[model samples]
Target: MLPGEFVAFIAALMAVNALGVDLMLPALADIGRQLGVTTANHRQWIITAYMLGFGAGQLVYGPLADRFGRRPILLVTLLGFVAASIFAASSQTFAALLGARVLQGLMSASTRVLAVAIVRDQFSGRQMARTLSVAQMIFFLVPIMAPTLGQLLLVTLGPWRYIFYALACFAAFVLAWSFIRLGETLPVERRRALSLHTLAHAYRLTLTNRFSLGYAVAASMTFGGIIAFVSSAQQIFVDEFGAGDRFTYLFAACAFSMGIASFANSRLVERLGTRLISQAAVLALIALSVAHIAVILSGVETLWSYMAFQALSMTCIGLCGSNFGAMAMEPVGQIAGTASSIQGFITSVGAVIVGSLIGQSYNGTTLPLAIGYLGIGLAVLTVVLVVEQGKLFHARQAA
Candidate 1:
């Protein structure tokens, strides 16, 4: 990464993005109540709506970054995101809120996919992974503090709308800072032509890369599974466990445990390599999910106990994220922007499938959650195994 000063800028940029996702958790319940989210399952759209906007717009950003350069593209999207957040905060109905959230998601996706492209534009392979890991570690602090911060806003201001107002101010700060320091990574000579032919070429290259697709699909499945929980967490904890006002702190604690794993993985990934760490972590998550399912079956399940394994499962997710992302970005260094677009599309497709499972089924039991996690875990394990060696346990030996 850069020195502390520039690194903090990147981290702050990333922190603003993190705030977009994690801050909503504290207010999820209140949002449900205020908007007549009458069913436990209905509330998931609060998060789902955002992801729908966020992931779908990434396809546009890839071309934008490649053609226009990253700096101007990023600033424009941040401003759009700020506008959407304002609309979201002012919405008086679920439909309006959902629309605003979708708009916010579309604009904010530039912050995400473009940021990755910026990092990739500067470096590749191990160096890129290390930089991303460092960025992620620093950015991870946002989720840890964000829920607590959101909770404060909800309690003191007596409404969730204030959180959106604050996000607008945060976005303005990031835009000003980004405008000053976020230089264009893609120079004029290096620009990819904005055309269907170029897009097709990028897609062909990305599709043909076995290593890149394997990791992308793995990361997609992993994130899909995790977001199912995120979408359902408010309902599960508040309605099922009566966590209520303390839910944000508890959620933050769980989030901290997850972020901690990424820091640990950062120390090991270079030595172990991206492929090794991700392969191993995927298996570990499968094992943990199997064990957790067994425990639930044996009737020892409760909120406290669930948190233990859940935290561990989330740790697997954290380890997989930075490593798998680096793995996907490893071979596609030539077309990082477009490759990221493809990756975002693939992952978002999985998210819609996975998020819908969590959203549509709200039985007020962990069985649904357990079944989803275990099934997805096993499915990912199978996919990775098949992709690697045509058989399980031969992942490390493949290629």
Candidate 2:
């Protein structure tokens, strides 16, 4: 495949997760009402449950992919994802829906773990970062339009379940494309045999690498903040600010800002290196979070103000996220699948807990989200300092 096509394909696989979450935003109210859910905060369980499962599920896929190779495991996972989506669409109760969502998340874990492993198999260091940045730039498009598309489907199809059915169809399409276009990247010579001992060894190698482990923790904290914002976005915009129908537009704008930042990172990472760019980006996030929290404390909440701050904060996330992943994976290439799995599990599970806390703390204000962002920013900065041995902004020589 061409480089552009390769990036787009990888991005499409990754975007499946974003689609499952973001597309549900416009339909969350509808889903809740239909299922007799009256509690505002409890509605977030729909997203959090999936994230928790997604994180836990990565533990299985990493070892499986390492042993079985990427292509076969991915195909099997996609099939499960489609089945789970169908089950979710047919749910008659909130419990059933959540169960199916968890299953879907479990199956979707392969997309993230394997996609990163595939990229790592082909590229490393700054080039891997650049490829991921470009893929992320494309991946942002799904979030940019998913809300509007969900709203459109709900309006035209006359039910919220169709949103899930649509997701299944999209997964089916991607699965077909994978069958036709994607080949196994992990060769037989490099593949590990399936055994508990082998799995334990790979996990040990991944976890003991101070550089990778520290970044994994840092990335999880940063991801937690973003997930917190995502969980509360609909409430913040529609219920608090009264954006209503315009909520999709505002969400799209924030997503667009991230895409722009990813494009900028792709252009700059090779010359400036991942360490410098990511350090600068994390610091920028800290400053933006502080400013946002001050605005919240001043009692002057408005849609424009919220959007301005959030867009900049998300841009900072885009600038650092892929770079951090690249750096973490650089030293653990021999166990890329397990390393990516561990990384995904940490970030997803951490995000679920932190995000649920912040999301549930919504008291008709944006203070929780602001505080979550700032707290995570500071936490990630500290983690990065330790990872780099108390240094900041210096690029390491690539191995």
Candidate 3:
């Protein structure tokens, strides 16, 4: 693949995960009703279940990808994802659907882990960060349109299950494309031995690196806020603000704002450096979260008012997330696959646990999410500060 095609392909691969989540947002209520979900908050288990499985599966894929090769592992996982999606679509109960979704998430983990591994196989430092930002900029389109597309599919197809059917079809198409176009990025000479010692050593190397481990934790905390919003977005928009059918469009606008921020980060990271851009974004997020909470507490918040702050907050996350991931991987390039998997596992699993708590705390208002954002922002900043040794906004001289 050419450079542009490579970026688009990676973006598409990562977008599959986004599609799995965002596409379900519009259909959540329908699924709940059909599956006899008893409580309003309990419906969030659909997302939490998948995320938990997604995170747990990452623990193995990195080692397997290192041992086998990116291409074969990805193909197998994609096939599994397709099968699981089909099963999910035919679910007879809430428990059945949740189980299928978890299976699907387990399968989907390979796409995320290998995508990063493949990129790290080529680039490092700010260049890798730049590439990821660009990929994410394109990838944001999935979130921008997914909910709307889900709403459309739900309306026309008249069944929430059709959403999973559509996902399976899309996964199949991507699988074919990847098989045809993506060659093994990790060559034999660079491949790690398939041994427990090798895997354990890689994990130790990754975990022992302060930069890698610290930023991974920081990124997970920051991501917790985003996931919190995602889990509760439909409720906040439809139930609290009465946006109703317009919910997807408003959701898209928030996603679009993140896309814009990602595009800007792509341009600015190389020039301004990831450290500077990310730190600025995090501080901005803290301020935005505080203001957002005040607005909600005053009982004067409107839909647009909530959206504007949410979009700004998501933009901050976009800036911080790419930077944090790249920085975490910077010192662990030799063990890229295992390192990627470990970091991914921590971030995804941690985010899911925390995000779920925040989601379940929802009470017909934005207070939980807003406060969650503030708490997460503070936590992320503290982690970043410790990682940087109290340095703030200082770019590396070469970067």
Candidate 4:
């Protein structure tokens, strides 16, 4: 594929994961009602279940991709995702739906792993970060539009299950696209053996490397805040603020801010360096979260105030995410698939656990989310400090 097409394809692959989550946001309430679920918090399990599976499944895909090459592994996973989506659409019970969602997540895990690995196979250091930011800038459009699309489907189609069908169709299209156009980026000479010893060594290298592990943890903490917001967004908008059908648009605005920030980061990363840019973003996020918490505590918070704080916070997150992921993978280029998998596992599972706490702590207000963001920002700063040995805003020349 050409450079532009390659970036767009990467974005499309990553967007499948976003579509799975965001497309379900507007339908959470409807799904709850149809499935006989009464408690608002209980509905969060729909998203959480998928994340849990997605996280754990990464462990397997990384090693497989390293051994089998990216093309075949990705194609297989896309097929699995389509089947899982169909299974989800056919669910009659809440438990069954959650099961199908977990399966969907497991299949979807390959997208995250392979996208990062494929990028790593071709680029490194700041260039890799720049590429990821550009891809994310494009990928973020899915979140920007998915909830509104979900709402439209619900309004016109009159069922939540159609969302799953829609997802399945999209996955099938992607699968066909990959079959026709996606080429193997990993060379045979670079392929790792699929064995217990090799897997253990690759994972150990990923886990023991200070920059790799620390940045992974830091990214996970920062991402937890994003996940928390996503988990509680429907309730905060529809029930708390009475945004009703307008919630989708409000959510889209926050996503749009992230996309804009991602585009800016893509332009700035090569010059500023990932370490300098991401460290600054972490500090900014902390400060913003502090202000956001104070506003919520003062009882002066409104829909617009929440939106402003969230959009700014997400922009900082957008800056941090691509840079952090690039840094984490930098020292593990030889084992990119394994390293990406480990990081993906950490971020997805850790974020889900953290996010679920904040989501469940909802007391008909935004305090939990505000406080959650502050805690995440602080935690991320702490991790970065230890990892960088108290060095902040230090820029390294691009490789």
- Residues 207-312, candidate 1, lDDT per residue (tens digit)? 7887678777877778877677777777778888888877777777777766787787767766666667776777888788888888888988888877887788
Which sections of candidate 3 miss by over 4 Å? Answer: 397-399
Q: Which candidate number has the best lDDT? A: 4
Residues 4-28 of candidate 4 have per-residue lDDT tens digits of 9999999999999999888989999
TM-score of predicted structure 4: 0.99
Predicted structure 3: clash tally: 0
Number of clashes in every candidate structure?
0, 0, 0, 0
Q: Write model 2 residue lDDT over 1-399, tens digit each, in one string.
A: 778889999999999898988888988888999999999778888988888889999988988888889999999889899999999999999999999989989999888899899999999988999999999999999999999999999889989999999999999999999999998899999998889899888888888998888888887877777778778888999999999999999999998998998999999999999988888988999999898888888888688999999999999888878888888899999889988999889878987888888889999998888888888888889999888889998768861
Local accuracy by lDDT, each model: 0.78, 0.89, 0.91, 0.91
Answer with 1 or 4, whichever has the higher TM-score: 4
- Output the TM-score of candidate 3: 0.98
Q: Which digits, one per residue and each the tens of the lDDT, describe model 3 over residues 1-399?
A: 999999999999998899998898999999998888879888888888999889999999999988888999999999999999999999999999999989988999988899899999999988999999999999999999999999999889999999999999989988999999999999898889989899889989999998899999988888787788889998999999999999999999998988998899999998899899889999999999999999999989888899899999999999998889999999998988889999999999999977998999999988888898998989888988898899997876434
Stretches of candidate 4 off by over 4 Å are 397-399
